[model samples]
Structure formats: C-alpha cells, structure tokens
Target: MMTFKFARPLAWLLLAFIIFVTVSPIGERPNTVTMVDVDRAVAYLLLGFAFALAYPKQWKMVAMLLIVGAFAIEYLQYFSPTRHPRLHDAGIKAMGAALGLLAGWVINRWRETKAPNGLPFAER
Candidate 1:
C-alpha cells in the first residue's frame, strides 16, 4: 500500500497552471499546440483527474469544482482583451471532466483493492 501525500499539492499546482493558461493572452501561448478545443478539454481532464485523486473522500466537491471551474474560467475569458468566451469550449470541458471522473474512480477502486485495509466498508 503506497501513500501519496503529494497528490493534493500537485493537484492544486496543476489547477493553478490550468487557470494561468486559460486566462493568459492568446499571444502568450506557444504555436506548437493545435486543436484548441481538444487541448482545452485534455487540460481540464488532467485537472479533474488530479483533483479526484487528491480528494478521494470529497468527490461531490470535486465534481462541483470541476464543473464550476470550467464554466467560470470560460465566462471570465470574455473579459480578457485577447480572448472571447465560447460555449463550445465549455461543452468539450464537460466531456473531459466526465471522462476524468471515470478514470479517477477506476484508479481509486484499484487503490482500494490493493490496500491492506481494503475499501472502506459502510456502517450498518
């Protein structure tokens, strides 16, 4: 049974990075990345997955944060001088979040199976 005390901090760091990337000026980004919508989704997917791992006991909060964060970031983009908000991006973000949640669930289940204590048993 391995422990990951670093997961929370790393997840928060990644969340901040995602926020920076989202709000920064378009010209500030590198030219190498293509498929803007897909990229946004993938970034959010990773964010969601990381947060899920970090807060395994608070999945509802994680879900709300991911959803709200995705939409809020896109909404805030309207104020950016070089960026305009798009619902399309939000849509892709939702899809990515869903997939990330599923991945995290699977990872957590595997972790529980491998742990000496096993998964938490519900109280009767």
Candidate 2:
C-alpha cells in the first residue's frame, strides 16, 4: 500500500517549487548560457518526478497535472510585462515532464521487481 502520511507535505513542497519557477523570470538579456535554461528544465523534471513518486497509482493524473501546469505557467507569462509566452518553452516543459514520468516508472518498476515474489520487470 502507498503511504500518505508524508505525501501531503511533499505535495506542498512540490507546489511551492512549481510556483517559484512559474513566477520567477528566467534568462536575462541576450539569453546567455549563464542564465541556465537547462537547469530550470531539470528542476521542473525533478518536480514531476516527485509528483509521480508520490502518486504512482495515479500516473494519468500526474501526467495531466504536469502538462496542465506547464501550459498554465506559460500562459501566465503572457501577462508579465517582462516576459513573453513562447510555444517552444511549453514544448520543452512537456518534454521534461515526459522524461520525469519515464524515470518515475522505471524507479517504481525496479522497486516492484525487487519485492519478494513480485512480477518481473518488462519493457512496455
């Protein structure tokens, strides 16, 4: 059975992280590598992984949340005078979420396979 005792707190933390990323302006003038877009994407990916790990049985819901959240954030950027929403950014976010989901599934499968008498892992 999945544990809920710690999931609530973790969820809140993840939500905070998402909000921070969504609200904060990234990539300064000229869009130099120092701005670190890759790092930001990885951060979002980790956030997705956290959600997936906390709710493995609800993978569809997790995926939906990630996708919707990414879209919402990008939409919100449209309102910011300092930032403009870009389809490319949304695409990158989606890619990150997908990778995170894949990582989460791999981890879960590994755990399941390690369990006594559990079914062997099979690529799907």
Candidate 3:
C-alpha cells in the first residue's frame, strides 16, 4: 500500500503569496504599517521558515534556492514599470532568511526532543 504526504500546506501557501506580492505593482500594495526594510525582511523570513520546515533535511539547498529566488525576483522587478530593484532589499531578504532558518532549526529540535517523531506533522 502507498501513502500520501499532505504536510506543509502552509509552506505552499507562503510560496504563492510571495510570488504574488513580488510581481504585483508597488502602488497596489496595502498602506505600509512598518518600514520597507522591515516589511521585506518579514516577508522573506516567513518564506524561509516555510521552506525550511518543508525540507528539513535539505537546508543548504533551501538557502541556495532562497538566495537565488531573491535575486531572480529583484531582477524581475527591474523591468516592472512601478518597481525598482535594490541590493539593499536583497540583503534584507537574506538576513530574514537566515533568521527564519535558525528559527526552523530551533523548532525542529524542540519537536524532536518532545516527540522523537519522524515527521513534524501527522499524516492525514
């Protein structure tokens, strides 16, 4: 018999949200409740968290993917009429990703210590 894995749905949703926000016009975004740098970091932080949790064993690959993705998205923004690519934004994203990865590591450790379980989420 074969089983299916339906874990990490939140991660999938996070990826979709990231793509949408990245490509959308800057003017269309909601009024900022925080600084731009902080917003960018928070966005990428969640992205990194989702990815790290989804692929716990492949953190290095996740880091590379996140870095490449940050660059790719910024590059795409260069061509958008209302958006500009900035290295500082990318740096913020990298920092956020690092923090998120660290958080994910901590969560994984806690889960392991408490449950000694193979998977973080139960199979559905």
The C-alpha TM-scores of every prediction are 0.85, 0.73, 0.80
Better of 1 and 2 by lDDT: 1
Candidate maximizing TM-score:
1
Q: Is candidate 1 or candidate 2 better by TM-score?
A: 1
lDDT of candidate 2? 0.68
Tens digits of per-residue lDDT, candidate 1, 56-112, equal 777678888788778888787877899888888887887787678668767876777
What RMSD does each model have against the real structure? 3.0, 5.0, 4.3
Residue-level lDDT tens digits of model 3 in 25-111: 987766666998888898889888877777766778888888778778777786778888888877888888878877876775565
- How would you encode candidate 2's per-residue C-alpha lDDT over 56-105 as one tens digit per residue? 67778888888788878778876666777787777777778778877877
- Estimate the TM-score for candidate 3: 0.80
Q: Clash totals for all models, in order?
A: 0, 0, 0
Once fitted onto the true fold, the runs of candidate 1 whose alpha carbons sit more than 4 angstroms away are: 1-3, 118-124
Residue 38, model 1: Cα distance from true site in angstroms: 1.8
Q: How do these models rank on lDDT, best leading?
A: 1, 3, 2
